[model samples]
Target: MGFNRPSRIQENALPMMLAEPPQNLIAQSQSGTGKTAAFALAMLSRVDTAQKVTQCLCISPTFELAVQTGKVIEQMGKYYPEVKLAYAIRGNRVERGTKIQDHIVIGTPGTVLDWCSKLRFIDPKKIKILVLDEADVMIATQGHQDQSIRIQRMLPTDCQMLLFSATFEESVWKFSERVIPDPNIIKLKREEETLDTIKQYYMVCKRNQDKFTAICNVYGAITIAQAMIFCHTRKTAAWLASQLCREGHQVALLSGEMTVEQRADVIQRFRDGKEKVLVTTNVCARGIDVEQVSIVINFDLPVDKDGKTDNETYLHRIGRTGRFGKKGLAVNMVDSQYSMEVLREIEEHFNKKILKLNPNDPDDLIKLEDIHN
Candidate 1:
């Protein structure tokens, strides 16, 4: 709780959330802008610690984010030692017929659903507060929307509802009406969704190896507090990590195949500064808030399953670096005609220009750093 004062989103959303006769809220704020804390405080304030029941519940799209939210709730509720919390994620198994006595629960949607209905570990009717962190991503992902709707239906009529995320598309907005109808809403304009603090650029590479060399130049030229490299596929991420390792750089690789514990450990180690470079896919893209990440490299430009340009994913990728109004950088590697088309689409979608940079020049990188400073 090193918060000197309430952030913009917190100042506006927290009052409506923590007011008398609790109200439902739908807030949209950029990453690393205290959205989790706003909802965490609201959940903790609504719980009765002496009852030892699961009064508050929070769900995230991925296991890493669930654990991340759990840690924040843990730190903020330090004074109330009696306020116990439990995780309903994979690998944290509970025997059949066991009941959870914790006052707060944080988990992924499927596990949380099973615990509340099938396993009977938590009483859905007894839950007084429900928070869906990263709701846009949660609704967009397959199967998460249905499971979340089920959980929402199980809660009592008076239960307070909260949904938070950085960006929301037209489709997801329509879907929110079914979950929390007629809730107070707050969000930014489409043009302001991508922060001005993050300087954007695109470097044309003749081949994949040139892209790797360009990354090396960026690392050797700039004074990066930390850097995250995002690849669209696991093959590219593995190859880049190995190449960086061969260059005598400490790097970490994260992909979809890694177990929950392994992924959590890798993220924690990167957060602790054990590694300066982390090469990963879109798994860590949504809401992982690491303050030291000064730059992000799109080793591959983001695209949806149908190979169309995904502007929302691109925003989340760059949003990882610039935290709480700090300056950050994003560089995209364009190697093919398809990539070029995707890049152009992204620029037009965001209504901002992505400046061009020479991929082979070391001096060009220094200029970017100078501008960054």
Candidate 2:
């Protein structure tokens, strides 16, 4: 009901689930394509006002996503006044101690598991629908497998399950097969080779330190409203954010080290236009959407197991900008610290030329208007 126009996933899977015999559903779609609404609508349709002891449980990978999903539910459920909804976070209260039987419960895995064990908040046996958002990331993030399996065990034998992810690895698919009953599978056509919306560029530097000078020059020349700088680790993110702040840039750092509240607040400030730049690791790379990000700077390349730029991670990093058919820019800083082969992989996989920076000529730093312009 929200978009009026169904997403690719909803166009193919929603009708089948609503019309076909009751069966578990596995829907996979890239992020920002409205996969959240697909499952949210399905959960709302099946929820009954009379019986509400947590009929539907939605698990998200990050607190930000959990909160965002909760907000979406609030807006979508305005039509259904009788439907009561609540969210459980890592440190939040579990809805009135005495189970009011919330119609829908949205939470992260750790917090949800704690409440289920400590507060006896949600009786999974009463849950009729289960939706796991960002299924692949849930598996990749550690300390969730045991809790997820335990949560599955608590659910009723016949309850319908829905698993969604942008990238479906073999291990993640295998995990779903073990839990979900023989179910219908839907994979939307992913923009596999490269992001069409982003005008990607890369610059070669003499050394790792020179990369920062290149970024600083770009920073000085461009009037970007907002940007995200991706680093390899939390330490580097903090260092870069601090360095930019020293240069009179309004920047904030987000890494796994910071508390969840801190990260959430920083993201909100960035969204509010108070922060000009956010330097962060790849941790927040997936499923975190902030509009008006004109550029994405890869200060440190995302390397795979073989020490190469991971195509999926790079794609997702650049995908942050140029979203929803908008023009976006992605700049990569490469130096001798990384093998030329890695740079070659990025260009080869993306099927585009990587630009180089000329430090002597300041004119090279000028921002090009939109590609079409």
Candidate 3:
């Protein structure tokens, strides 16, 4: 809502998306580029608030993403008092055979599928707009892909479909073709995948304890409004959160093991600036936009199951900061040989250098802190 200018993707994609004859769109852009706002405006513009019969639907891969998207729409449509929104995610209950009368509905694929197929809460025939956030994840996951396709099949032929994400693979394209027909496409070059506003750096630590010490040094020296630390595993996240907590830092932890409501609550607290540091696994990697997050710490470099460098995850992790034209910082801690290789590959893939930082030096930490400001 503080957007002073339209981002590149928004400038090019909005006209087509908000046309009189609704159009389908498939857009690819880096995080912090106003992709969600673009789609949210389109969804709001298309909804017939006068009728209030679930005229528009937005689907995301996770509860957090769906909730985030719902918040955007809510903020954008705040003046439109007649517009009502409903979340189809878990814990949002509706009785059997209950009809949904909200103007906009948002939720995860499985829950949205249940509301459409089993619950019959919203009539697909009445929906005029459909949006899928984080489409690459939506299609690559088997269960999500199946449920998304099933939900698409139930929609009317004229329903305007929109898909937004940071990456689009060959498989995702194939899946997009199936869900959307003749969509206007918007894509960025490979080199543009990483954000330029976020100053990047790396500090090599000989041991895990050294990494923790480095983190303490940085936090002790800098006045970070909010920082997100990403770990390779849930165990690492829990340990780091506990360690930070013991050090008297207001810390919050999030991972796959936590329930949907618990995860949402943790994120809410972080957004409200109740936590100074948030330690997490990959759950908050994509589409979690917290504007106050000025620093993103890669406590452990991201790698896939086969130990391959996940460039997309790295981009998303850093993208959490540097949001909406704000200067931010991303610091990577290389504690092992494998992590060193992972960082090197990520550097080469993005063609960006990660400057060396001396964690023990006060001057070096102060410089790192200034990069974000």
Best-fitting candidate, scored by TM-score: 1
Q: Give the per-residue lDDT digits (tens) of candidate 2, residues 176-287.
A: 8876788789877666532666777777776656777777887777778789999988877877878788888889888887887898898888889899898999877887
Error of 2 at 191 (Å): 4.3
Candidate with the larger lDDT of 1 and 3: 1
Q: All predictions: root-mean-square deviation over Cα?
A: 1.2, 2.9, 1.6
Residue lDDT tens for model 3, 181-289 = 9999988645343567778999999887899999999888777889999999998899889989999999999999999999999999999989978899998898888
Please rank every candidate by lDDT, starting with the best.
1, 3, 2
Model 1, 1-373: lDDT tens digits are 8899998899999999999888888888876889888899998899897786899999999999999999999999999788899999999989999889999999999999999999999999999999988888898888999999999999999999998867777867876777886699988535355568889999999788999999888877788898999999999899999999999988999999999999999999999999999999999888888889999999999998999998888999998977888899999999999999999999888887899998667678878879677
The TM-score that candidate 2 achieves is 0.88
**lDDT by candidate, in order shown:** 0.89, 0.77, 0.87
Segments in model 1 whose C-alpha atoms lie over 4 Å from true places: 189-193
Position 89, candidate 2: lDDT: 79
Give candidate 3's error at residue 248 in angstroms: 1.4
Question: What is the full ranking by TM-score, best candidate first?
Answer: 1, 3, 2
Q: Give the residue spans of candidate 2 off by over 4 A.
A: 1-4, 95-97, 191-194, 206-209, 220-223, 304-309, 337-339, 349-353, 357-367
